[model samples]
Structures are given as structure tokens and as C-alpha cells.
Target: MTLVFSTCCFSPFPPLHPGRLTVLPQEALVQIGGSIQLNCSLDCPDGTPQWKGLDTNLGNIISTPTYSLLLITNATVAMEGTKFCVGNCQGKSHQGSTNLQVYSLPDTLQLETQPKELVAGQPAHLHCSISKVYPPGSLTLSWYRGDQRLESPDAEEVADDEELFSYDSELEVPGEKVTEGMEFRCEVELLLPPSDRSFHRATAVTVSTKGKSWRSELGILARWVCNFSCQSHFPMSLAILVCQG
Candidate 1:
């Protein structure tokens, strides 16, 4: 007859909580035509989660609680904005969002050749030209020979008021003591402020030496003449040869 007394002995169960999404690399500012990966994770393992892109219907549902959305190929300005992830856990739903920023970079870069190919004991000139750059900054040009930087007498820089810059460098080929058919490289760098997010372009050339000896040629000619004279017997040995003084 005391059934009401049993209700006072039972404890109430706790309410279910919703799932959450955590993203690594919280903020991203990347250049266009680059790649990025957004790692997302859910705290609970109840149901499959889905990812949605802002202003687009590109949605993907994954079985695992943790997933990575990769901009595997290339990124553009159009790819910037908020991305979202929605999931359900313990009969409750949650969502998370992230913002992306995209930037543009320089386009054209080339090396102007002054003796594009060089030999030892020779002088060479190299110049780098950059086109289509924004927010002009200081430019640095360097000459490298097989991973080792070469010293130059003049490191000249020229810039236009409209955000274009160029650098010219003159280098002398090292003597035989340091020559080994090495590779030479010319590099151009655009210096950015505060963060040093510089962009670099480079070109390389091969260095070699010109043949400077006639001894090898004379030896081959002598061998051919001796072989011909031995085969012919028409008084070839009777002819007298004299050397000039």
C-alpha cells in the first residue's frame, strides 16, 4: 500500500548534451592558387557529421567523427568565406563555423641573360625582372653557384613608383681552381613588411670550359697518316718534310 514511497528512492537521469566541432589552425590567410587543409573534429560519436561551404551547396557527410577537408589542388579568391560543420550527438545537434581569407601574389618573373652560359675565367651579368606586383617593396637579387652564393661587386636595384622593382647583378666566373662545370643560379625576391612573406623566383645556367689544346687533335692526325703510309708503297717515304724556323 506504500507504492508512493518507491518514487522517493529513485534518482533522476542527466539530460543528453549536444556534440561540438573543433577546428585546428583556427585562422587562415593564404595566397590564391595555393592549397589548404581544414581539420575538423567532433566531441561526440553518435551520428555521421556533414560539412557545408558558404554560399554553395557542396556538402559532404563522413562516417568518422574527425575529418579533413582539403583544398587539394588550388584555391582562389572565390573560395574565401565561412565554412560550417553540423552534427548530432545524444539526440542533440550543434554546428561550428570558420572564416577564410585569400590573397593575390605576383605573376611574371624572369631572368635577363648576359652570357646565359659561361666558362671559367669569364665575366657574366645577370638581371631579374618582375611584372605584375602589388604594394611595392624592396627587391633583393642574388647569384648562386652550385648552392654557394657568389660575391658581386655591384648589387644594383631599380624601382618604379608604381610598385614594380628590378635588380641587376654582375658576377665574374671563378678561376680554374674553383671551376667544375658547376651550375649558376639567379634569384629574385620580393620583400614584404613585418611578416617577411617574400616571393622568390630563380633561373639556373650551366658553366663549362672551352677546349684550349691542339695536342689531342695532332695526335689523331698523326695516327691516321701512319696507318695510310704503311698500306701504300708508292714512294710515300721518299718525300722530305721540313719545319719552318
Candidate 2:
């Protein structure tokens, strides 16, 4: 009688790791009509990576086992949105995302004096306008006189003639600060996330009347010399002496 035994060993499956997906340039900032690119990576050596958001068709999309890339060209405000990077490994999925923000600086910034003339003790107006702006809430208008900063006023919505937005605001001129020739500067700032852009524009308004012009007074003096030979030792009459000119 003979006994025979057979044994076989099987290896367990490796752990599943979708891996951590990383998106380069966590956030993107692009101006209108410009373009941007985002890089993506899945740490796992065997993971499949892909870009899942934005206008993927705008540019080339490179997908490899180690990394993926998304390119956006001729970008517009409409293209601004959340972009995602997705990866899969061992039937599990992992992902990460970034925000694409698109903005435009004011097309035309203008500062003007309403009346184009200012007078001490008289109220005048300073006007600031920002045209062709995007992301409505980003526009801000500020006023300044010389080296001093003035208060900010509520911005008024100007009628939009095109697809973009326009904003304007007026500040009452400081009668006390008004001078014969002085410039008032208006600064327009577009407060975008991660940055702030500024544009300085100023307009000078001359005072209609120079200061102290009304209260100015003048006085005249006349000097007269009369040649008179006093008679030797002659006493001149008091009234005649006083009248001599």
C-alpha cells in the first residue's frame, strides 16, 4: 500500500489602492480670451488617470498610466468652472478637483469732474466709471485727494450697452479741499481671489473763484510835497501849514 499527498500554494491578491489624485495649480486664474493648462497625477503606479471637467475638447488631453493633462485654449468666462481629476485602481475610484476662475480687467476706466469746475464753499461732483467688467461684484471705486484717501461711495449700475457690465459712482467734492487747481484721483480695483488689481485715474477741477477773493481789500496812499520858502523867521499860520500839500 502506498500513500500519496499533493499540496498547492496560492498567493493572496495585493491591496487595492485608487491612490491619491493630485491636481497641479490647485486653482487657475485666466483672463478672457486667454488659455490655461492643468496637470494631474495618481500616485499609484498602476492607476488610470483622467481629467473630468471643463471644455476638454478645447485642447489636447494626454492620458498615460502615470499622469494626465488638460489644456484649455482661447478660454472665456463661460469656461470658468470646477475641473476634476479622476483615477481608478483595482476597481476603486479616487478624485480631486480645482476651480477655474476667469476674469477681465475694466476695459475703460474714466474719472471726470461733473461740472469740470470746482469752487470753495460750493459742492461739486467727482465721477468714476468702470466699463466692460466681468464678475459683477469684483468692481470697486475709491476716491482720493492729494495724499489723503477719501471715503468710498456706493457704486451705481450703469446701463450695459453690450454683453458685459458697467459700473459708475459719484462722490461729492469736498468743498473744504477744493482749491484753485487740484486733482482728485479715483482708483478702480478689481478684487479677485488670490489677487487685487488696481487702476489709477484722476481729473483736475479748478476752483471758479480763488480762495479769499471775496474778502480781499485794498488801500491807497497819496503823498504830496509842497515847496514853500518860509519867510525868514516868519511864523506860518497853523491852518495854512496843515493845508500845505
Candidate 3:
């Protein structure tokens, strides 16, 4: 690899030795809320390296006679950028930089099913929603039923707020496949493990085929309620009840 060096000079530092200055890990990729340290060392002690950035929030800096260090504790997405350590090298300014990138996962995953109850031979709509995701356009959402992959809607992304995103994956089920006791789920995939905010990535909702028929069950429930309504304090007409599948 071809190695190129830069010369940077400032009035505050004395003339530096004509030698090499190396900054470990020229680039850094860290998770949000994580910490990282960038080290800059000079071959000769004639000059001291200092860390600086256009933004003060880039992090804290520590300097010693031996080396200069940039410490970013509790790093946030806003702090991702290039930081520099420059010193006067042989009457010229020599510089090194650290490129930092921050990443995070969605805060919560949710699954929604249309007409909460699923019946055999009934068409149903299921949707998976991901909220508070960072670094948009890096998400892939897929749908699954048990061990089988289901035909899912194209995952869509939306800007929820500045620097935050929301995603949705929709799946439409044909009535023939609609059956009770089948679990459907959605997952948000990440490129690496220890992903930021990644947890219980999937949401599963079971399909139900309870009750012989929706029409009959509603009639039966209504009749059963009215049978004792006159005797009961609450009138059946004024009472509302939800049937369990």
C-alpha cells in the first residue's frame, strides 16, 4: 500500500523532528452510546500531537509527553465525523485524522394484523412496523410464518424525525392459507451482531380459525346475551361484548 503523509505547522509548537507520525485506526466504526480511543504518536519527541475537530462534541482529548489520545466516551450519532491531530513537523504542519461512523438499531418492533381474528379461507393483512430506527436506508424487513418464508410487502421507509426513521413491511395472506394456530412474524436484519438497540427483533401473531363461522358465531353470541338480558341489570342491547377466537 502506498502511504502518503501530510505536513502541518502551527505557531504554538516548536520545530518537530523530521520523522513519521502514525495514528492508529485511521477510521473508526462504533455503535451509538459506545466509546473509542484514537492514538497518535510521533517517532520523535520534538513535537506534541493535539486533537481537534470542527465540532466541540467530537470528544475529549488527552495529551502526554509520550503520545496524544482522543477519547470519545458515550459517543452519539451527532459526533460522527473526522477529527484531527496536527503538529509542527520540521517547521511544517503534519496532520493525522480519524474518521468516525456511528450506527444504531430500531428502538421497537411491532406487528399489526387486520381483523385480529384469522379464520380459515379468509384473507388477512399483517403488517410489521419498526420505529425509531437510526441511519435510514440500511434496514431489511422480512416476513415468516413458522419456518416458512411468507410473501411480504416491500419494506418501506419513512422519516419519523430528524435522524430517526420508521419502517414497515406488509404481508397479504390469501384466504386459502388463512388458518388458525399459524404464527406469522417479521424481522429486521442487521449486518453485524451486537447491533444497536437490537432485541426480540421479530413479532409473531397467531392466526385463528376458531368458531364454525363468523356469521353464526355473532348470531349465537347475540342470542345468548339477550336470553337473560331482561332479568339482568344491564340491558343486552346496551351491552357490548367481544368474542374470543
Candidate 4:
């Protein structure tokens, strides 16, 4: 009697995987006219994988059973946003996303001056104009004297083209604080994605004080100190006195 094989008694269920999805380079900061590449992977991949939130026509994309790659060419400010990819893992759909930020910086930073001569004790005006910057909202302008931060001024309101914008800031230096040969610096900070970057321009003014040069003043003070020290320690060596002077 050929025993018919007992009907197989086994339950089939889909694999138990979290279906974790990952996107490499989750955040990117790219200059305008640059390119970016992103990778998406899924755990226990199953079916076809695809990309979303970006125009496929603008990028080169490769898909596989477990991962997908996307390379965007000639990136522009309009393409700055979150991009997503979807993958199938264990019969379930998994998705991952990355953030893209595009920015531009001026080739040169120039602080425009109103007067040819910056005289001490005179109210002076300076203007910093930054052009062709993306996401202008992330830009800030600050003023500094030597290593001391003076102030951070609000950007002047301007028409936004949505692609590129210009920032203009005007700073007024009070005459009372102005000193001859004092340096004033204008710094621009880009609070873009990934990190913050800074650039600066500096200027100085001339003081018309009717007094001996600072060098001469220092020399006189040095001589007074040397005389006092020599008198306190009488018969001090001339070489030591000269060294102190």
C-alpha cells in the first residue's frame, strides 16, 4: 500500500524584517552649477526599487533589487529640497529621503565707502552688498572691530527672484568711537546646510590728532621706566639699561 504522502503541514509567512531603509549622504550642500549623487538601500530587499521627489529626466538613476543610485547633473537652486526613494523589502514598501541645499557666493566682498577719507571723530557710513546668493534667508552680515563683535545688522528687504537673491546692509559708525588707524571688518556668514562658512572684508580710517606718533609716545614711556629702574638699582650696567629701553 503506497502511503500517500501526508499533506504537508507547514505555514508560510513573509520574512520578519524591519524593512529598514537608508539613504547615504542624508544631507548635502552643493554650490550652484554643481552635481550631487545619492544612494538608497533597503534591508531584506524584495522587489523593484524607485526614486521619488526628483525629476528622473534631470538625473541618471540606476535601480537594483536592494538599492538605487541617483546622480543629479547641473544642480540648480530650484532643485533644492528633500528627495525620496522607495524600495520593496519582504513584500513591504520602504522609503528613505535626503535633503539637498544649493547655494552661491560672490567672487569678491567689497565694503563700499561713502567718503574718500575716513577721518576720526566723524560719522562714517559703509555698505556691504552681496550679490547672487541662494537662499538669502540663511545669510547674515556682522560688523567687527579687531576681534570684538560690534553688531549684526538686519538685511535690507529686496525683491526675491526665488532662484537667487541679493543682500544689502548699511552700517553707521558713530564718530565718538572712531579712532585713527582703527580697523573695521565686515563679515558675512552663510548658514547653509551641512555647515556654516564665513568671509570678510576690512577697512581702516586715518586719525588727524595733533600729537607725537604712537611710536614716539612708547619710546618716551620706555625711557622713563629705564631711568626709574636704573635709579632704584644704582650702578646698573649700561647694557641692561639699553636692553630695557
Expressed as tens digits, the lDDT of each residue in 69-180 for candidate 1 is: 5342366545667777676677777677666655443654566555655655566555655554433444666878788887765445455564344445666553462354
Candidate lDDT scores, in order, read 0.58, 0.69, 0.71, 0.71
Q: Candidate 1: what lDDT?
A: 0.58
Greater-lDDT candidate between 1 and 2: 2
Residue lDDT tens for model 2, 72-157 = 77877677788888988667798888888887764456767756656666667877777777777777777777667888767876
What's the TM for model 2? 0.65
Q: How accurate is candidate 4 locally (lDDT)?
A: 0.71
Q: What is the lDDT of residue 50 in candidate 1?
A: 60
lDDT of 4 at 195: 56
Per-residue accuracy of model 3 over 129-244 as CA lDDT, tens digit each: 87666666667788887789876667888885457778877788888777667777788875532334333466688776565566787878766666656568865545455223
Off by over 4 Å in 2: 1-18, 53-59, 114-123, 158-163, 174-176, 194-245
lDDT of 4 at 184: 71
In terms of lDDT, the poorest run of 10 residues in model 2 is: 218-227
All candidates: CA RMSD in angstroms?
8.8, 10.3, 12.3, 9.9
| TM-score of decoy 4 | 0.66
For model 1, which pairs clash? none
Candidate order, TM-score descending: 4, 2, 3, 1
